[model samples]
Target: MALNRQLWIAIASVMVIAFVSSLAISFQSARAYFEEQLHLKNIDNANTLALTLSQVEKDPVLIELMIAAQFDTGHYQRLELLDPSGEPIASRTRATDAVGDVPGWFAELAELRVDPGIAQVPDGWQQYGTLYVESLSGFALEALWDTTVELFLWFFGIAAVLGLLGSMVLKSLTRPLDDVVDQAESIGNQRFIATPEPRTLEFRRVVRSMNILSARVRDMLGEERSRLEEMRQRLQRDALTGVGNRGRFDDVLGALLADDDPNRQHGLFLVRLVDLAEINRQLGHQKTDALIKELATRLGTVAGEHRDSFSDDHLARLNGSDFALILTDLLDAKPLAERLTEAMQELAARHAEATSLQLALSAGRFGPGDERSSILIRLDDALARAEHRETTCLEWATQGEDVDRLHGSDEWRAILHDAIEQQRIHAAHFATRRIDGRLIHREAMLRLEDARQTLTAGQFLPWARRLGLLPQLDLAVAESELERLARTPDPDGEPIALNLSIDTLLDESTRGRLLGLLASHTARAAMVSIELAERAAIDHPAAFREFCAVAVPLGYRVGIEKAGLAVTEIDVLHELGLSYLKLDRSLTTDLAASESNRSYLRGITGMAHAIGLTVIADGVRSAEELTQLGELGVDGASGPGVPE
Candidate 1:
């Protein structure tokens, strides 16, 4: 065991010994403290009573009966009357059930002793009798019992607190060992990572060793990674262009084509320089390489714009003035090619004027039904056909399909409007999450249905915005949803959350109507939460703040959605006094071994908690992500992991 545990055991044993010893001393002292007072009180009362009894002319039997009656009612230990001869005539002992019912073993253990009161009697200035009295020990027994129980209870409670503190110390000391192991494993597995050291001396030594080991292991892995990266560059990288070579591009294209879905076609754009040999003849090899490098730089800039559009797809330079891109999840093929050509032309125009060589891009697409080997043949043929073409960009068939998909945007607006008017709104999909088993968060989903078309937000919202009707369309969706909700399965006693857009906020009439309708359902509105995206939040901060100020007092709770994006303005969210905050999806999706995202989430989540705002992480799609969020102490979460 570590020193903390050893210290705990030693201190506990000493405390146990000290507690027992102190208890013994306290018991005896308590008896002495109360007994002294009890005995003194008895003496005073007996003396006063005897003086009073001396002037009385009652009969002897009556006097004895009166003294006995007082003892019966009072807390007297004993009462005795002696004749003028100094012989005991009448006697009575205290008979309270308090002392009588207690076990003798307990009374003896405390060394309880209650002194009896004694008094003198006088008849016409001569001694008549002596009175002996005993007060009840029950009060003293009760006091002693109370003191004993209280003292022991104090010792036990303090000892329990000490035990808890000792355990915490042990945990803190051993805590760094866990971090050390984690760092070691990360280093050994070729993950370059480090952890903070433990505070304890003994564990710090072990942690220092692990730190050194972790550093050495990381250094070794870094050296190895550098070596492999160089090898990869040498084998499949172009020396002058500094981009992936033809072999690498070939491999990437093969994999992308193989993975294409039947409904989604993948596009390949091959850009071939028309005059590489001509440029080399006029300019030396060095200047030709310089031009190619400039071309490569421009291509990279164009590629950066589409980086976040998809995953596992990349753009690379194949060879002299030749580049390729693998576009997946493409709904259609034609417009993507035209867009690529327009983007490249825009980027190309930025280069110095009077450049002899221009960029030529020829695109050939392969669908799930196309054979991989034949796709390359078609691409090569397209490149060959573009050799003498006048235009810099050309597409090989399927051009009209891209034009049709481009036109689909206008159709989406009509589709959304018809879905709302024709009562085609599908059943709402809402997800629920519990926090501390006390509060539940309901996340609402918008479902669209048509004979042959159903739309995801990603596909339809852009069209709504483009048509300048998103405000009207959003209200329609909201009204349809609420109208359907009002019909059956009301959201009473449940906190239901919905979203509002910037366009809606700009519309005074729609905003008033939306809030008015929601306010009518006061009970549900009290449990209702309205949310807006961070981009929209920042864009219309003034309007949103005003809206929230009015809505919140009307029994509505407001939340800033995609909160992780505005981590810098966490105080802005706090100032608005939000009831809940939903973290950005991208932040949660990037939580695997990413130091930046984890730190960002931690800081923002801490800020949210400090402001008394409920923190809900959205798009927690994995068990590992859920566990990580729980460890970070997120208030609640709703995603695929949460059941509907």
Candidate 2:
């Protein structure tokens, strides 16, 4: 039984027992008083009758008439007169019909007994006869019944009022207890949350202890995240300028090009400092190194300022004099080229030693199916062309050969809107599996079929976000998956995971529609899980929390995808109530090769498991990597390398 119910039962039982005991004691006391009063009235009436008879004539007929009159006038059960020889002279008895409105059971329960009063009537110093009178108990019984009824009514009413008040008070007292239980459940689920202290001393102490635990876990997670971040920087970043190195750039660009989605396109820029050896000798090593660092910082600032232009961007130092910038889904390269040229000029002007410095800037576009070597060769050719034009020039390698698929924002918006309206959106399922080769779930990646070709989310998602059409596209995918789940007759069919953009989750109307759609198909809702990028939770913490608060309780699992990209604030998972984390491909690639990567994975898995979160690694390209991930405590793996 629930503790609250038990407490209520205990309180009710006590009230009932008190009421019964009080009623019994009160009734018994009232009954006894009524009996004693009856006895006293009988004695008084008998004595008065004897005195009246003694004062009157001692005729038998007269005595009999007096007895009848007294019995009729007073409430007497019986009246009698006896001669000196012990024989009855006159007698009067009351009938049983005189009992009033009192119930029989009550009359019996309150039945009163009193001895008949007896007195001698003397005539001239000689004993005459004895007069006997008994008082009727009907009147006393009726009064006792009335008093008992009144007492019962008063006690019943008071008890009802007290019972209601007690329940409310109990609820108030136990509310804090309920909050504590919820906190414990959250901890068990790997989400650490703190609750306010209750007014009750015991509950307050318990809540304080739990808050301490949550805070400690949060601190530990923060430290772990920092360590992972440090490891990632060491493994992927340029040691001198604090940007991505040649290897990291190759890994990222290779992954992009390797994707099957033809829509994966980006604008790439390669900046080379001309006559670097001469400049280095003139400026000395320290000043030249500072100048290189300043250049990297400037590129980082530009990327930050124009972050919205690209969904994903990379800035890297290929060598001492060569730097690269790749921006995904950039429709216009001329404006960014102009911005880069201005930044380069500012760098040269700021550093007086580089007044005679020359820079060659080259720009090109690459997409899926393009070889990494061919793209780099084209950019190199463009850099050589820029050198011939002047000391510094911006040269486009693909000139008129590669035009953007869409001309302007309006065209992009129209195409995306029509794609959604025409039902051109669909899903492609990729299975995620456990270490034992059991199916976990299939992730449904959204695909859009246009007039010319098919586009993956990676190819078109940034444009959709720019056009404010993500909510519509996300809903389309969600609705399709829900329909598919509903069509599957098996209740235990494999679950499917669908991604929702942060913008969709933030839109109030879209969120309502999504929740309503899921609710309308409650049975299938559980067979579908919703996912968002880890950056979503870190950027819009309140919105993510609100969505999870509603979605998780409605039988839909909520998780973070691409989790390890933002390792510094990943500890926010403790407060976001996420069910799982999907490690990004960069972290999982060549998992068995790098000791640093293995250590980072171990730390991530350990922290995630301690908090009760399932960890899944993405882009596991080989069985060896899968095995290594399993050994590192990853719960699941998904990629082309994983078998169906």
Q: What TM-score against the true fold does each predicted structure earn?
A: 0.46, 0.85
C-alpha local distance difference test of each model = 0.65, 0.81
Highest TM-score: give the candidate number.
2
Residues 312-394, candidate 2: write the lDDT tens digits. 67788999899999887775667777898888877766765444777888998888789888999999999998877766777
lDDT of 2 at 188: 75
Candidate 1 Cα deviation (angstroms), residue 162: 6.7
lDDT of 1 by residue, 221-313 (tens): 344434434554565467777676765565455434433133345567777767778767877788777777776776665554553332223
Q: Provide the lDDT at 269 for model 2.
A: 93
User: Which segments of model 1 are wrong by more than 4 Å?
Assistant: 1-16, 23-103, 110-200, 206-228, 302-321, 329-355, 358-360, 371-382, 389-407, 412-644
